[model samples]
Target: MTGERRRLRFRRFATRLERALDGGGAVRRRRRPGVCAALDRCGLSAYYVPAEYGGELTDYTELHQALRMVARRDPGVALAHGRTFHAVAPVWVSDDAVAAHRVGRLVVGGTRIASSLAVPGMGPEPHTGVSAYPVVGGYRVDGEEWVGDDLAPGSYVSLLSRTSPVATPRAHSLLLLRPDSLPGRGGPSGSRRLAFCDTRVGADALVGGEGRGAEIVLKARQLGWAAGSALPLGAAEHALRERLAGSRPPQTRRFAEAYADLLLCEALSLVAVRSVHLLPGELSVTSAVVGLLVPELTGAAALAEDAHLCREVLAAQFRSLVRGHRSPHDHRPQLDRLFGAAEAVVPFAPERIGLFSRHGSAVLGTLPLSVRRLRHLARAAPEFGVAAGHAERLLEVTDTLHQRLPGPAVTGDPGLGRGYALCFAGAVCAGLWLGGGPAVGDGPDGLWRDGLWLEACLTRVLAHLGVRPPSGADGALFDRLATVMIRQYEDGRPFSLLPFPMAEGEPR
Candidate 1:
């Protein structure tokens, strides 16, 4: 399909999905069959398959937007259905054409696949309790596995199994097998316990070469971390909207601060997703930052409303960061393509994805240049002065962070990690605003006009870093943000940088 037509297709699907869940009570209590049927009918699985395998996925940005659209209404449904994409990610990353074609065709044909791969913000270790012993024709699979909540009798299960007795990264391997092929009984919470008493299968079931499971799974998890950030972001948007709708809405300060947090989350998510295609090698750090910060910001939003659930969520974000971080290598990213919303992304190549970033973080490393550009823009357009000032503050914060950050030999400092994440977020906002992505509009009332959104975003970042601005300055910035948010709500637009058209009709 043409680019315009493809975008239209996604928009239509989003509208259809919204209509499908109308009046469906609480999302967690809703029937899975009905939701799955709606998702399948809308061809959600097609986006999980690569284009070379007769699927429609070309850009991670489109998929990210679609997931966020789904998540805005119901995060539970988004996770339930989006797991299909998560299950297939490893196959794509393995770069095994045969396995890719097979899984891709099955996914395209409306087949659901369940996997044991942990979701983003969850730890990266797969359930390795299952063991696969090598045999004459193939491996003799044995042991119980904990699959996802959506597994079915005839559907396929992708698992990471121990191939050797030694406990090492290279001792495990991935296998894609049919549930029916193994002798197992259904377990509680939609998991399966495989009692594979000498069950045998052809060697073709292995996803990649033996002992390569850790590498492939790591890369796949990086992709998941970047894409999965949309879930909380959408939920946060839902919370902000609900707050605005109440009879006695929150003060302008509360609304604006929450809205700014959501925007910063989106900025980080957008850059991380695009890096999967443009800077796959640098994804290790980029994805970790997203996995860490999105939840913290969302949790803070929840905390403002006295929701205690965010405490657990914040813990998960920190755990995910500790598990995912590694020493950085160096490689420059395609800044033009990375920040330009209209630019076409190159096709995804799994081989290009590295286990760890060759360079630390392209987004954070380029902060100096971004600050310089913002200063130049400030000179050219006096209205940009606020954004430039914030950019300069960000540069100062990041430079100090770099000097104080512990050497590679010592890692896992919570304060240092959070500081780095906030700095990266600041850089993303600066780069995106400077690049004039689609999120930045030229209309008289646009959020980017006079760098209003950027100034608010940077101010929020600085506050998070304990670098407080003038006492009342934040209130004024937040008040302005609240006004823009109300305007978007009245016009029935999503609270996003991109102006996606919401489902037509009265606001929900």
Candidate 2:
């Protein structure tokens, strides 16, 4: 389905989900029992399956849109459903029939899934306390596993554990285990540990072969990077709606900045999802960039706090979506240490940057050609105006970073990574806005006004990178865009690439 149709479908569900939350923003713990029924009733559970498994895996773009919409109302619901997709992504990629069937059955049956992976940076000890030993028939597992608090009973949980005694870094494997398969009781626990023991499973329980845990988990992580990032993007969009609803002038500029940032993120996220879909193996760096930068830019926690949403609930949802996932933020030292040991690598190529692929260059030789063509088009197109300038400057900065990035001793500084993310986002916004021509919205000079928004984002990125631009920049552009955004929000339209109608219920 097209993204527009997907948004419409999600809008219908959003109404139901909005009613389900009843303005609290998440299903209460004591009310967890009926949550799956609510989700199943809305047909949200089908998204958990891939098309091959007889579920709605139309495309990443649609799934991303749906998740973002669901997140706007209840972030926890989106996190749970999205994380289940992460758990089963490896199964789909592995093409293991048994595992695929198992996952399909669960989704069709409206069962939730949980993921349990050893936390990165945890010392040699497995934080999950889950260990699988080879046994007759299959493997036996005995340890307490970590699971989401809202996971319903009889849910299928994916667990990663060490399968080899003489362990190297990659000795772990993935197992699809059930609470009933294990001889212990499993349910929501105050301690957050699902205690299991002497769980003997048949060989069919293994999703991926022995010692494939790292690969399987990495696949899941890559799939999750964009989906996980969308959670915060959705939250920020909702917060912008709430903040702009007040129609306060003093905060208009800030809201405009936030709206611009959110739009840029939407573009970057679209690029990231495309990257994962096309070049799955080479996305390690791209996924890290997205995972680290989306939440940082969206400021979901800060947005929640600012919107007066429940802090504790937001924190818990973030922990489930963001903290449990690995990104450049978690492995900065690892990258620094590894790159420090390697010999000097290849210099930066413009095509090597993610933006080049976003433009649809079919071959390496077409990259520079594509860039030249875009520049020529921008020059000829008066509508591009300032946004084209932002894109050009972005190429220069990306070139500088790429040239220096391949060398040894490059510090994996997260702030610098965030700066690069902003740079990329600015480039994407500029390119997309120019290519999309004038936006259909409230402003008289919508395209020109949006060009200023692009400039503002580039200004923030350049400042973060310590690159000074021509001075005398004013907030006038920001104020104008903010006015447009506030009007858009108050008019019952969403602040997004596609303006879908907001929930008809009264704002919190």
Q: How many backbone clashes does every candidate have?
A: 4, 0
> What TM-score would you give candidate 2 relative to the actual structure?
0.75
Distance from true location, Cα of 26 in model 1, Å: 9.5
- Pick out the ten consecutive residues of candidate 2 with the lowest summed lDDT: 333-342
239-289: candidate 1 lDDT, tens digit per residue: 777778883666678778888889888888988898888988777677777
The whole-model C-alpha lDDT of candidate 2 against the native structure comes to 0.56
- The 0-to-1 C-alpha lDDT of every candidate, in the order given, reads 0.72, 0.56
Question: Would you give me the overall lDDT of model 1?
Answer: 0.72
Give the winner by lDDT. Answer: 1
Error of 2 at 32 (Å): 6.1
Estimate, for each residue in 219-272, the C-alpha lDDT of model 2 and write its tens digit. Answer: 555567755667888788777776665564547656777777776677667656
